[model samples]
Target: MSADETPQGYSIFRDTMADMTFPEIARAAERRAVVLWGLGVIEQHGPHLPLGTDVYMPSELLRRVRRLLAERGIDSVIMPPFYWGVNQVSGAFPGTFVVRPEIVIELIVDLIKSLKKDSFARLFCISGHGDALHNRTVHAGIARGADEAAIAAYFVGAPSFFARVGIAADDPHILPTHSEVERPSRYFDVHAGKFETSSMWAAYPGLVRDELLPALRSTDFGVEDISEWRKGGDHARAKTPQGYLGDPAASDREFGETMMAQHAELVAAAIAAQVGAAR
Candidate 1:
């Protein structure tokens, strides 16, 4: 990927994966390179947002991160966003496309195998879809593959790397005016709320239904599964009928820009730091 080109002008993630020669990939891996794979879901986001909110936001963020990583001289590739994920809560909702946990795990494991076989030293699963079940799958898949497949290779989550960057050390509320996130903001309203909405605005403004955002509100809420008015398990439709748990009115684009930049910088820096350490 060339820096002279804008993020919008950038080609497919598959192109990056296919760009390098086997020998070149091996040499880079021997020297400790990092490859980033974005994880997200194609699920319902309320009336105000598109189904691909998770994928769209992270695609833009990862693009910015790719540039930052390049500036730090890190040999990194941002894989295409992985949309097939376990969206248990949203499954009963009309637009949500949910996958079983084990299926997600197996796919991640296969990806790890492919990257390792091609000589990528470290694999960073940078997820935008933050479901507990999905997170567990990605973490476990990486752990299992790195342990049994490639002993010297590294596989881990982008969150842990963000922790190393320090901003996400304790769930800070990220500021919209600047990169300063308030303490414990990360812990608050993580589901399809302001963060997701404003993020949709920042990355793909045309896709967001701004006028409809005012009408979308849900007072009844429970962080735990409340079943989408369905049998056995609770879902997004139950706790958040509109499929959003945060304040859509508060999804400030200014804050979103700051948040995306902060995330990109932290992710890039963390990868560079870890690659340096591994070397």
Candidate 2:
């Protein structure tokens, strides 16, 4: 093989993972290893961001994390990303798809079980969906399904990162003066709305609908706290005609890079810890 094509880098995004023979993978297990599986919702991301915002963010971060870990001689692979998720908030917006909470959990369990069957001893789930309670419950289910086949199945994104980034503990936008916020809005939009818009713009520029940005509305009217925000239903505060909560106009690529870099670092560190513990 050519030098460039060699598995010199540890990233699964590279051809190396695809080209890896079963024997190759088994041999590599003698060192240290981990595999990352991603789950993202294909739902509304306000007026400017694409419906695939949630999916794209985790996938992109997994790619970057794979590269980062490779730099440290860590072995990692990013499996195909799951687009199914509990999308309650963006359901009011067109193109949003909601998978029932039970289905999401069951699917995750099956995914983890299969990974364990394949001898992947360490697994992590990365989600960018609306239902916090549901996602955590689902993660627990996946861990249960893994049983003794693996060590643990973890959910990477947590409230701590938002806290660390200085995002206040208020719901970004869930309730408007006229409507009751639903389950989807309460959990997902904590950092949804403009924050998600800016993030998508940073990760995948072409997915953003720039023309819609000007028309998007930025309002604090619907939000009471972070918990009351609606995840679904035809609420008055569900979305502005433009579909964003805060001002996506203020979003820049730099901020997106910063957010993504931090997430990658967290993933890499977690993988390192999990792999070490497995040994």
Candidate 3:
């Protein structure tokens, strides 16, 4: 194998308790081992993206981030994906498995406590789906973590970074509103648009049908909060019947691969920074 393709001696699992030894685990934990958890929604992602699109995208980041951390002697692992995330808007879609918001929060809280009990140095949760309530819940759980564990917890994804790096700033469109302050006008979706389609195409070719781009591409857009979406997935279905909000035709694998690589880079850097800061 080429040097770049070599495997670093790090354990990446859906669950970490089963495969690690006590002494080995202790060595890693002492070195500030960071657990990278991939959180995603089992929801609908238009025609071109797969139903597990949210989880898969962030999992890709976790996978690559493990390799980066391994190279630096910072023990790290990617746990099995936590797919039951908050997908209130996608409830209208057939594939969506919407769970109560509290369910996700509780799951996160329990997992954090479990990891903290295990003596892990830090835990970073990366979610592909952007649910404000979900993010807030995760943050709250992190805040409640004990001082000794001092868990470094937060959410990371492409959309948040896109805005951070001036990509969103260029297009003054506020999603539901082009530009203006409005109540519950807090969310916007390019749905199966560029990011979702491209990332899926890059990671899982079997799961994506690039030929369906014509059917998936559309200019339909909408805005709604978690409460409205909780009413039912039908509302979202009515907003964008195709289950997408942006053009999938322009989603090329090359662009998708490049975007995913950059995303992985950004996420890995963030984890590294958090680990360093925690120390």
Report the number of the highest-lDDT candidate.
Answer: 1
- Please state the error at residue 42 of candidate 2 in Å: 0.9
Candidate 2 per-residue lDDT, tens place, 174-264, comes to: 0011111121322233444556665666766666777766655446544353334453465524444445555665566667666677667
Q: Could you give me the TM-score of model 1 versus the true structure?
A: 0.76
Provide the lowest-lDDT 10-residue window in model 3.
174-183
The per-model lDDT (C-alpha) reads 0.62, 0.59, 0.61
TM-score of each: 0.76, 0.74, 0.74
Q: Which ten residues in a row have the lowest lDDT in candidate 2?
A: 173-182
Local lDDT at 30 for model 1: 79
Q: Model 3's lDDT to the true fold?
A: 0.61
Per-residue lDDT over 1-279 for candidate 3, one digit per residue giving the tens place of the 0 to 100 score? 211123532222333434667787677677767777777788887766778777767766677778877776667855677787666667767888877767766677777777777777566666677555455544454445423346555554445433532333232211111222111212343467765677777766667877788655445344454234434457656667777766677677777777666666666666666556556
- After superposition, the stretches of candidate 1 with alpha carbons farther than 4 Å from their true spots are 1-32, 151-188, 218-235
Candidate 2, residue 13: Cα displacement in angstroms equals: 8.4
Determine the backbone clash count of candidate 3. 4
